[model samples]
Target: MSNTPLVQMIGIEKHFGGVRAVDHVSLDLYPGEVVGVLGHNGAGKSCLMRILAGAMLPNEGEIRVGGKTVTFADPNDAREAGIETIYQTLALADHLDAPSNLFLGRELKTRFGNLDDARMLEESRKVLARLNPNFKNLSDPVSSLSGGQRQVIAIARAIYFDTRVLIMDEPTAALGPSETAMVSDLIRQLRSEGIGILLVSHDMHDVFDLCDRVVVMNKGRLVGAHGIDEVTKDDVLSLIVKGELPADWSARNLEAAQ
Candidate 1:
């Protein structure tokens, strides 16, 4: 992994009237690393990610991409900065085919200002093949594809544009065992390609299996961040449920204090 982070969110804060949706949160995502964000429904993990994805603005914070401080007025700005977000919905047009959906808003056009369907299809095929070799339904509407296959389309769309940072929200939420495994393999493949990923999930198994590090949040506060080897599932669970560090970590802090 690179010593420098591909993306850094520093001291992020968001408020909704009297409620603190997010509170002074700082997080980093390094190239070729998968960092899992864990939290309950309102723990602010989603809120923080939305800020990074440019879906929401932070009341107090700054974001850095590729080591340069930047501002994102909208999601398009974030995408221009090489950040892409795959929401839980996958956000595909059910009626559109893979190629059409891949080039939805940013369609390829011919010299005369016509839709370059052939070129878009060819490019979509190549990206999908890279992500999933068995994805052969290029002409099929996305609604007809399976869950894992739909995920491939979503991912291919994101990475096809040279995405350096990917934020996946509950990637395997409703996937079956086999489909989930397929998504897991795709994530590993992306990591090997040096793409930094922020995986927001509630599944402990997925976190332990796919993430190099995990950050836990509760009641809009980050309670703990730990490397996979430095903590157990129970440790992470405790942090999520009670907002407390593991006993061993507490012991180490006590020793350091002395």
Candidate 2:
């Protein structure tokens, strides 16, 4: 890990009406590392991520990207700073083809300042080929692609832009084992490319298999952050339910079982 963090959240707090959705919380995401955000519903996992993604604003806090503290005025602000979020809905235009989806908001333009359909198609194919070779043609509408194919588009879109920090909300929430494996490989590829990632997921398998570290939350507060090898499934499960290290989860614990 580097001494400088890619993104850092310090004492973040937010609320909806009288309900405090996120209490003061601090966390850091490093380059080339995937940090899993794990918590039950209403544990403030999504709210915290929303603040960082600019889907929601925090009334009080500090966000630093690449060592400079900054505030995201909105989603565009975050996106301009090289932060891209892939929400659970996948958010792809069903009628659009893979290339159209890949370059949805951002597109390649011809010298005449018009959409360059051919170039977009070629680039989309290149990016997808790096991640999923079997991904169908870029000219085909996303609606015709399978779940895994759609996910490849979403991830390929983010990677093509070289997003510095990526946030995914429940990426594998609803997928078959095969689909899950495909997504998991994509994540490993992302990590290999040295992009920092924040993964919000409830699935232990997703976390253990793909994350370098795990950050847990409960009642809008950060409960703990531990290296993946430093914690076990049972310990992580306990933190999700009880909001702290399990009694048996010793800081010095070096399980020989692994």
Candidate 3:
């Protein structure tokens, strides 16, 4: 991972009328690293990520990409800024084939001004090969594919362009063990390629296994951040359940400050 943050959300706050969905949260994602964002339901983790992904607007905050401030009016704005988000839904066109879904909004055009099936399929093949070599159902509708195959389609779409930062929400949520392993391997591959990743997952084991660091949130506030090697599963669970960092974690943070 690079020393400079690929994306930074500082002092982010959001509210729905009288309810505070997010509150003064800050996070940093660095190149070639996966940072897991963990929190219980209604803890504002989704709201924070939505703001980062440009699906929702933050009431107060500054977002910096490559150390320069940026604003996301909508999801398209975020995408154009090289930020891609793969939600839990995968947001795929189930009736369409893998190649069609990969180029749903941004299809290639031939010289005569027609949908270029050959070009799309060829490009899809390249992206899919890099992400999932075992995927061979190019012509089959995504609905006919398995959970992991569908995920590969979504991820391929996000990464087809100049993707700098990727946000994955519960990537392995609906997958079986084998499918989950595939997604895990894909995540590592993307990280190795220098794509900053923010992984939003409720699965403790997934976060511990795949993330270089973890950020815990509670009641819309950031409770703590921990290195994977420095904190145990129990330490993270305590923060999620109680919004309190373990004593050892606190001591470590204090010592680092000193």
Which prediction has the highest lDDT against the true structure? 3
Model 3 Cα lDDT, one tens digit per residue, 1-258: 668999999999999998888989989999999999999989999899889989999999999999999999989889988899898899998899999999987789999989999999999999999877798999998999988789889988988989989999998888888878878998898899999999999999899999999999999899988788878899999999999977687687677678
Poorly placed runs, candidate 2 (over 4 Å):
251-258
- lDDT ranking, best first: 3, 1, 2
What lDDT is obtained when candidate 2 is compared to the true structure? 0.87
- By lDDT, is 1 or 2 better? 1
Candidate 2 per-residue C-alpha lDDT over 1-258 given as tens digits, one digit per residue, 9 for 90 to 100 = 788999999999998999888999999998899999999999999899889988898989999999999889888889888899988888899999999998987889999999999999889888899877887667888899888788878878777885989999988776777767877887888788888999999889889989999999988988889999888898888889998887756634845544
lDDT assessment of candidate 1: 0.90
* lDDT tens per residue, model 1, 54-143: 889999989998789999989889988999988888999999999999988789999999999999999998989877788899999999
What TM-score should be assigned to candidate 3?
A: 0.91
Please provide TM-scores, in order, for all candidate models, with all chains considered together: 0.91, 0.91, 0.91
Question: What local distance difference test score does each model get?
Answer: 0.90, 0.87, 0.90
Better of 2 and 3 by lDDT: 3
> What residue runs in model 1 are displaced by over 4 Å at the alpha carbon?
252-258
Worst 10 residues of 1 by lDDT: 249-258
Q: Candidate 2: TM-score?
A: 0.91
